[model samples]
Target chain A: MSVTMDKPPVADGAPRPYTLRQPRLPRWTPPALALGAAAVAVGIGIGAGLGSRIQWGLIAGLLFVVGMYALAARVEGRRQAKDRLATSLVWVCFLLAVVPLISLVWETVARGSKVLDGGFLSHSMSGVLTIQPGGGVYHAIIGTLEQVGIATAISAPIGLLTAIYLVEYGRGRLAKAVTFFVDVMTGIPSIVAGLFILSFWIIMLDFGYSGFAGSMALSILMMPVVVRSTEEMLKLVPNELREASLALGVPKWRTILKVVLPTAIGGIATGVMLAVARIAGETAPIVLLVFGSQVINNNPFDGAQSSLPYYIYEQWAAGNEASYDRAWAAALVLIAFVMILNLVARGIARWKAPKTGR
Target chain B: MDITPATSAAPPPLSGAPAPAEQAKSATRPGDRIFLGFSRGSGILLLVIMAAIAAFLAVRAVNALSHNEGNFFTTFEWSANSTPPVFGIAVLAFGTVVSSLIAMLIAVPVAIGVALFVSHYAPRKLATPLSYVIDLLAAVPSIVYGLWGALFLVPHLGGLYSWLNDYLGWTGIFAYHDGAARSLFTIGILLAIMILPIVTSVSREVFLQTPRMNEEAALALGATRWEVIRMSVLPFGRSGVISASMLGLGRALGETMAVATVLSPSFLINTSLLDPGGGTFAQNIASSFKESGEIGKDALIASGLVLFVLTLLVNGAARMIIARRKEYTA
Candidate 1:
C-alpha cells in the first residue's frame, strides 16, 4: 500500500505503468563484457599481426576498461559510470599483477617436475659436468641446511635476549638507539651483508671462502628480522601476566623466563622460522662468500660449499640446456623448502594462539 | 628486644623466619642482575655489529678509492683488474637510480590499484584469500624472479619493445636498438613485479585501517561509495602510500639477482631504454666479483658502501614519515 501511494502520477485514461525502472547496471555486465572484450582483443591482435601474448593481454585490458566505461555511462548516469570505471580499473590492475606471478609459479612447477625425483634429490653434482644430465641439488641442499642452521643458532639467542631487553627492561637512550639501528639493519642489502663479512672476516682476518663465512653474513641479515618479529610478539603479551608472576615471590628474571617467554613461545618460534626461510633463499651473500662448489663439502668451516640459490644461479649462468634443467629443479626444491617453512610457521601460530573464550 | 613491642605484637613464627631474610636482602636480586647483564650485552653486541659494518666498509672503501687510476665517482670504465685499476661507479649509480625510479613509478600506482581492489572492491571471501595469496607471492625468492625474467620475461618483451620503439622512438628514450631484450626497461618491469606485493600489502593494511565512523558519516550525507572513499580513505592513507613506495624503492635499489640476470651491461649509458646496456650497483657487484683481484674486490666494496648508504637513507626517510604519521593520527 505504501509503495502504491508513491507510484508515478498518471491520468485515469493513461496506460498503467509496468515494473519500476532500475538505476544500477546489471550485476553480470562487467564479467560478460570482459569476456567479450577479450575476444575482441584476440581478434584485433590476429588481424593487426601482433604476435606477443603480452600484447594480446594489454589490448584486452584496454578494451575491457574502455568498453566497461562506455557501457556503464550509457546504462547508468555519469556518476555511477565513473564509480564503475574506477572499480573496473582496480580489478584489472589486480589481475594484471596476479597473472604474471601465477605464470611464473606454473612455469617453475611444470618444467621443474621433470628433473625432480628421489634420484635427483639424493645425488650430488661432484662427478657431473655442466653439459651432463645426471646431477642434482643434493649438495646444495646440504649446504643450505647447514648454513641456515648455523645462522639461526648464532642469531636466535642474541635476538631473543635483545627483544627481552627492549620489552621488559629498556628505559632510555640506549634502547631507542637499538630500535633505530635495527630498522636500518633490516634494510641492508644482502650483498652488503656479504661485503661486511668479507671485509672483517675474510679480508682483514685472513680467512678463506667457506660456508661459515656465508653463515656469518646470513646471521647478520637474519638477526634484525628475528629481533623485529620477536619484539612484536613480546609486546603482544599483556602486562598483567608479568605483574601476577612478580606478585608471587618470584624474581623478575624468573617471571620473564617462566611466564613471558612461555606465553609468547609460539609467536617467537614462528618468527624464527620465517627468518630462517628468508635467509635460506639468499643468493647474493652465498655467491659472494660461499662461492658455490660442485662438490659437497659437509664441513661448513673448511671450504667452499654450494647452496640452493647459488646453485640455481651457477647452473643458469652455465648457459646450457642440461644446466638449465638442473637450475629449474633446484628452484623447485628451494620453493618447496621455503613454502614448507612458512606453512609450518603459520600452523604453529594457529595451533598455539592464546585461548580466549569464544 | 626483637624490635621492642612490634615483634611481640606480630605472630612469633611469622616474625622469626623473616628477620634474617630482611637483614640479608640487597636492593636487587642476583638472578635479575645476571639476566639484565646478559640482555644488555646482547643489545650492545648488536650496536657493535652495526658500527662494525659501517667502519669496515669505510676502511676498505677508502683503501680502494685511494688506489684508483681514474676518478672513482665519474669514470665510466670498470677495469679494477688491470695494472692501474681504472674503475668508477658513474654508470652503476645512474642505472641504479633510473631503474629504481622507473620501478617506483610503475609499481606504486598499480599497487595502489590492487590494494584498493582487495580492501574496497573485492567481496569479503575473495579478499581474504587474495591477500593470503599475495603474501605468499611476497615470499617467492628473488632468485626465482631472476630465473623467470631471464627465461620467460626477456623473450616475451620483444614484441612490446618493438611496439614502444615504433610509436615513441622519436623521444630517443624509447628508441629500439634490436639487440638483446635485456635492458634497464626490462629490469624496471621485473623490479616492479617483485615489489608489487610489498606495496600492495602495505597499502591494503592502511586502507583497511580507515575508521568506520567517518565512512558511515559520508554515506549518511547521501554520498556515493567512491565519494565516501575519496573523502575519507585515501586522505587517511596518503602518507602510508608514500612510505610504502619508499620501501619498495629501497628494495628495488638493493635488488641483486633479477637485475643481474635480466640486464646485459655496457660501460656507456645509452639513451634508448630498449637498447641492452646499463648496470645497477648490486648487479655490478655480483657480476664483477667472481674474477676480481684484491683491489678490484675493494672497489666493489666501495660501490656496495654507496648502495648501502642509499638504501639506508631511503628507509630512514620512510620510517620518519611513518613515525610522524603515528603522532598525527593520535
Candidate 2:
C-alpha cells in the first residue's frame, strides 16, 4: 500500500490526473433514499390527517425515520455505529417517558368528556349511587380547596419563617440540626405523614375523622417542600443587599423583612405555589384523616368530607362504567388545577427574574 | 421635623462611649442578648417541629407494636381485618424495596444517558425542546401515571410478560403462572418510567455545570468522547448522581397511585416477580385506607411509620453524603 501510494505521487508530481470516469450510479442508494424520504413525508401527511387516522401516520413516521437512518447507515458504513446507538437510545428514552404521559392525557380526555358537562362541575355527588351515576364532584372539589387552603395557611408562614432562619441566621449547631431534620422531613412518605396525623388526632386524641386532620397531614407534607424551596430562593439573594440594609441602620429582622424577602418574593411565591400543587393531589393523607363523603362538609373539624383525589378513588374503585367516567372527569379537573398552578408559578418566576442587559 | 444626621451622630457617640467600657463589663446584655434570644428561640422551635414529627411517629409505632397480635417485622400475612387482626408489613416492605431497586436499576442508566446526550451530544437547537419535554414529563401528576399504567401499559405488557416468563422463569424472580398482565415487574417498570424524567433533568443540569476547561483538557489529551465523560464528567458529578437517585427513589417509595393501580394485592409473600399480590407500603396504605376498619387503619399507620423511617433514612443518608462531598471539595 505504501509503495503504491509513493509510485502514484511520484508519477503525478504536478498532480497525477486521476481518471474521473462517468460513474454509474448505484441502483439501490437513490431508490432507498427516495423511498425513505417519501415514507417520512407520507407518515407526516397521514399524521396530520383527521381523527384516529393520525395514529397510523405517527407509527408510519416513526418507522420511516428509523428506516431512513438504517438506510443511511448501510450506505455510509459502520463508522457511525456509536452515534446511531446513542441517537436511537435517546429516542427510546424519550418514547419511554412520553408514551405514558400521552396515554394518560388521552385517556383522561376520552373518558372525562363523557362527564365533563356543566352539570358534572356544578352538581354535587350527594344523591349519586353506584347503580346510577349522574351527579358531579362539586363536594369533593370544595373539600379539596378548603382543606388545601387550610394546609397552605398552616404551612406557608412556618415554612417561610424557618427558611428565613436557615438562610439568615443558620450559623450554629442548632441550625445544622434543623437543616438535617428538614432534609429528612422532605423525604417523608405522604402516607406516613397521613398516619402521623391520623394517629395523633384520631387515635391519640380520640377525635373523629375531619378535614382539619387532613389539613394537618397535608401541612406536614407541604412544609418541608416549602422550606427547602424557599431556602434555596433566599440563598440566591445577594449578600450585598443585606450589607446595604445594615449600613442604613435597619434592624436585622426588618432588613430581612423589607430588603431580603422582597427581592426574593417572586421566587418565594412560586415555591409556595409548587408546594400547594404538590400536596393538593395527595390522596393517602386525606383518606386516613378526612375520610371521603358524598355531601360537602363546610367545616374542617366536622365528619368525613370528600376531596377530588378521594372522590376519584371512590368512583373508580366502584367498578361501574359511569362511576369510572366520573373518576376520569375528576382527574381531569385535578390535573387542570395542578397544571394551572405550575404555569402561573413559572410565569411569575420568569416575570420577576431580575432584568439583565441584552 | 428636621431629621438631623447631627442627632444620629450624637447618639452614636454617647452610645459608643457607654458601649466600649461598659460592653466589656456587660457583654452579655443589649444587642448580644437580643440576637442570642431570637436565634435560639427560632432555632429551638424549628428543631421542635422536626423532633416532634419523629417523636410522634416513634410513639405511635411503639403503640402499634404493643397492640399488634403477631410478629410485627417478619410476618408476611396482613390479616389486620381478621378476628384478632393479625398482620405485618413484611410483604409491603419487600415489595417497596424490590420495586424501588428495580426502578433504580432501570431508570438511573437511562437518565444518565439522556443527561449526557442533552449536555454533550445533542445539537444546540434541539437541547431546549428536548429539555422542555423532559420537564413536562416531570410535571405530569402521579395519578395520571396510575391511570395510564392501569389502562394502557397493563394491557400492552402481556406479550412482554410472557416473553420474560418463557425466557427467564428459571430464575424464580421472573417466574409467572399463566402470565398475568399485573405484576410487580409492571409496577417497577411504571415507577421507573415515572422517575426517569426527574432524574434526567437534575442530572442534566449537574452535568452541564461540569467545568468546561476540565472536559476540554481531557479531550485535548487524545481522549475519546466517552473517555472524557468517564474521566472528567462522571467523577465531578458522582454526588449529583447519588442525589438524583435518592430523589428518584424518594418519589418511587412514596408513589401511591401507579402502584395502587397496577399491583393486585395479596398478603402472602412470593419469590416470583410476576405474582399478582405483592404490595408496597404506599400501595397498601392507599388501597386499604378507605375501607379498612379501625384496627386495620392502625395497622396501616404502623406500616406507614415503617415507610416514614425508610424514606428518612434514605434522604438523610443522601444529604449526609452530599454534605461530606462539599466538605471534601471545599
Candidate 3:
C-alpha cells in the first residue's frame, strides 16, 4: 500500500497496466430506477383496473427488483446484478409490510375518531338498540378490566411457580413433562381454550355465561405466556444470587422468594403485563364464555357481561351502519388499550432490566 | 444424613429446609414442605389442564359425531340442530386447509423478505423502528384485522379479483362468476397480512443469529453481499424460517374472526377460489355458535376439536423442527 502511494498519481491518459479494473454501477442508479419502476407499475395497475394497492405494490416490487438487476448487469456484472436484486427486493419487502400496517393504524384512527369522543368512552349500550347510534364501551371496559384482572390473578402465580420449578428445583421426568406440556400449551388456540372452559365449566357443571367463566379460559391462554417469559427472566438471574443466599444459611424457598423473585420482578411484571394485554383483546373466549351483554353487570360470577372485543364482534355481527360505527369505536379503544399495555410493559422491561456492569 | 454441598454450588435440600448433616438431618421445615407441594402442584396442574382439554373435547366430539346422520368426511351440509342432524366437516376442512395454505404461500415469502430486509438490508437507524412497528402489527387483535379486511380490503380487491378471473379464467381455480371480493382468496390475503409479523420477527431473530464469522468467510472469498447471504445466512436460517412458517401456518389455521368476517359462508365447496362461500373451521364455529341450538353448539365444539388438534400438530412440528436445529445452531 505504501509503495503504490509513493510511486505517484497516474495521469488520465496512462495505460495503467498494473491496475485492477472492477467497474461498478453508480449508487443512485438503483433508487432512481426503483422509483421509475414503481411509477410505471402504478400506472399499469391503474390502466389495467387493478383496484387494490396490494397488486400495485406487488407489481412495483417485481419491476424494481428486475430493473435493478438488469441495470446492474449492464453497468457492472452478473454477480453485482444479483447483489443489487437482493437488496432492492429486500427494500420492497420492507415497504410492502410498512404500507398495510400504516394503513391499518391510519384507517382505524381516522374512522374511529368520528364516534370516539368522551361519551363513547363513558357510557354503555344500556337501552341503545343495535341500530341506535349513542353507545359507549364503559360496560365492556369494566368487563375487560375484571376478566383480565381475574385471569392475571389466577395465571401469574401458577406461571411463576411453574417457571421456578423448571429453572431452580426441576429434575428428571416430571420437570421434562412439565416443560414439554408448557410448549404444547403455548400453542393452544384461544377458541379451543374457550371451548375447553365451555365444556368444563358451562357444559358439565352448568355454570352460566359470566365474566368469571371468560376469565377461566383467558387464564388458560395467559399461563403459558407468563411461564415462558418468567422462565427467560429467571434464567437471566445469575447463579451467584441464589448461591449467596444459600451460603448465608437462608432457606431455599426464602432465598427464592426474597432474592430471586425481587431480582427478576421487573421482567416478571413485564411478562405478566404482556399476558394481560394478550387476554384483554381476546374475543373468541369472551364471546363464548361471557356471552356479551348490552347492559352493564358489575358482578363477574353471576351473569352475562360486556367486554371490549366481544362488543366489537357483536356490533359488527349486527350489520348496520350504526353498528359498524360502534364496532370501529370499540376496535379503536381495544387497540389503544392493548398498545398502551404493551408500551408500558416494554418500558418497564427496559427500565428495570438487570444491570450487568458488576 | 449426607450433604452434597461440594457437588453443587449449594447443598440440595431433599425437602425445602434441611436441619443439618449430623443431628436430625432428615427433619424439614413444614413451610418448605408446603411450598414445594404448592409449586409442584402448579406444574402438575398445567399438565392436568392440557389432558383435560383433549379428553373433554374428544368425548364431546365423539358424542356429536356418533349422532350425525350424514357421512362425517363426505357430507357438505351442516344441520346438526335439525331432526336426524345431518352434518359434516367436508366444506369446513377444505376451506380451512385451502385458506391457510394460501396464507402460508403469501405470508412466508413476504415474511422472509421482510426479515432479510430488517436483518441485512436496512440501515441500523431504520431497522429498530421498522421491527417495532411490525411487532405492534403482531399485537393488533385478529378482530381488528377482520374489521379492516371486511371494511377496507374487500372492496378494494374487486378489481384484482376480476383481473385474475379475466386473465387467468382458463385455469379453473381463477374462474369467477361473481365479482364479489368476499372469497377464500381475500381471507387468505388477510391471514397473510395478519401472520406476517410473527413470521418476520421469528425469522429476523434467526437471521440475526447467523454467525458473522461465516458471513465474513464468504465475503473474503470474493463473493458479493447477496452471494454471502445465500451461502451463509440463508443456509443457517433455513430451519428457523421453516419453523417460523409453521408457526404462521398454525396461526392461520386457528384464526377465527378474521376468516369469519371475510369469507362468505356456504355448505358447498367451489373450485374457484375467487368465488365465495366455503367456510373455515374456526370461522364456522365462531359464526355459527351464536345462532345454533344445543346440538349445533355441540357440532361447533366438535369442529373446534378438529381445529385444536390441527394447531397442536402444526405447532408441535414447528417446535420439533426448531429443537432439531438447536443442536446445529447452538
Candidate 1, DockQ score (0 to 1): 0.66
* Best-performing candidate as measured by lDDT: 1
- Provide TM-scores for the models: 0.93, 0.84, 0.93
DockQ (Cα-based) for each candidate: 0.66, 0.32, 0.64
Off by over 4 Å in 1: A1-22, A356-358, B1-27
Which residue pairs come into collision in candidate 3? none
lDDT of 1: 0.90
Q: Tens-digit lDDT track for model 1 on A227-328? A: 999999899888888889878877888999999999999999999999999999899999899998998899999999999999999999998999999889
Chain A TM-score vs. truth, each candidate: 0.93, 0.81, 0.93
- Candidate 1: which pairs clash? none
Candidate 1 vs candidate 2, TM-score winner: 1
Estimate, for each residue in B2-31, the C-alpha lDDT of model 2 and write its tens digit: 688787667678775776775465445466
What fnat does each of the candidate structures reach? 0.71, 0.36, 0.66
Rank by DockQ, highest first. Answer: 1, 3, 2
Candidate 1 lDDT, B1-330, residue by residue in tens: 666777676667765998667535622578788999999899889999988998999999999999999998899999998988999899999999999999888899999999999998899999998998898888889999999999999988988899988999999999986766999999999999999999999999999999999989998985667777889999999999999999899999999998887899988888987889989999999999989999999999999999999999999898889889988989
Report lDDT per candidate.
0.90, 0.77, 0.87
